[model samples]
Target: MSLLAQLNAPFMYLLCGGIILFVALVCVFFMIRAYRAGKAMGIDTTKMKRVITASATFTLLPSIGILLGVIALSGSLGTPWPWLRLSVIGALHYETQVAEAAAEAVGLQSLSASLMTPTAFSTICLLMSVCIMWGMVFSVFFNKRYLRRLGAGSKSGKPGGGFGDRAMTAMFIGLICAYMGSYIGGFVSGNGLFRCAGSWIPLGVVAVACLSMAGFMWLYEKKNAVWVESFSIAGSMILAMAAAVGLSALA
Candidate 1:
């Protein structure tokens, strides 16, 4: 390989950044739309900022996890990069006992594929549960925004009557952000003449996240923010899947 090419082993990082940037842009668009809706509904910008920021921070991890998961699904790495696949598969299965029990708590998303086998990219859709779990906490807080807007007053940690709505809204917002962010991530995950640069994903998303939040704040004073769940469960999940793949690079 050429010296220049050698310097950029694993260009997926760039693509990741692009995907993040795109998500932020879309998020801002959605925010403006939501703001308009809020205006029509009398949603206060001051509160909008607070609520959005809170919601974003709460679920940023899951959103990123989902992105990584999607990339994994796409097999954009073609051959699983060098050690990423091995680490992933091995970790998933070795922890089978742990995973099975933990999965029951969240409806049991399939963590069957050990991250060790040949690079086929086939695995269960167990990651969704992770998304839902992280999202649940975020959802709880979101409803508070609505309640506060309705003149219910303010407080945190303690649950309020309108918590459900805020929770649901936060879930919805988280979903949208994750979905939009995926697109941004896609744009910057490779190193080829056409592939995205993975490193760029974090930067792109951060940039977009900052810009979107700023726009919402300036225009309305508001707003809201990993990989796609490691692209599985938790950083802890890395152990089991890594074993399955016969490797443990990031666990």
Candidate 2:
């Protein structure tokens, strides 16, 4: 059987569907438990319902981005895998990066379904599943201690007050800078198989995304458009993707 055929096989779909259903059930169980606990604590049932409704509504908007990510990856990785990944604990950027790297490692120029073999697909799946588990493992084992340390630091009122928040902000900024730097470097160095006029497309997409995000932030901060905050990231991502498609076609 072909790689794509294997990936999108009936068993693959069944497995993915079963896992997703299990996760959804688990989430629902937790939500029910939390709701009951809130009731015990004398929180108004109506307020709780409202909170749930608002959260679900807000979640739908961000999930548009996730849907887009799944569509983007489906072309190369097949639908079932990407759907399962994005529907569960996967981040779009992390999955894309890992998939691309794994493809390269398996001697594929990129993650094209046409070029993928069963061996290459297996390698990508293994790497994606194994490498991403460290974060979850660390959280499970050390998160409490890390949180306690942060709490202690916050209470101490020392020179490094609010160090946790600052550190998180710094880490986020560093991550953004790292991605931006890689994009710029790739464009400048004319590296890999993408050494063409099309190589600049990523940089252009990044610029559009940045500008879209900045514009949303401006609306939120200056015009007090509170609704823009929730949509900012997802909207920018969609716009950036559209820009990429247009640029790719033009290139």
Best by TM-score: 2
Count clashes in each candidate, considering only residues at least 3 apart in sequence or on different chains: 83, 0
Candidate 1 TM-score, C-alpha based = 0.27
Q: In lDDT terms, which candidate is top?
A: 2
lDDT of 1 by residue, 16-38 (tens): 44555676688789989998888
Considering summed lDDT, which 10 consecutive residues are worst modelled in model 2? 189-198
Stretches off by above 4 angstroms in model 2 are 152-251
Which parts of model 1 are misplaced by more than 4 Å? 1-10, 60-251
Q: lDDT by residue for model 2 over 170-215, one digit each (tens)? A: 9999999998887777787766554543278889999999999999
Backbone clash tally (model 1): 83
lDDT of each: 0.45, 0.84
Query: Lowest summed-lDDT stretch of 10 residues in model 1?
Result: 223-232
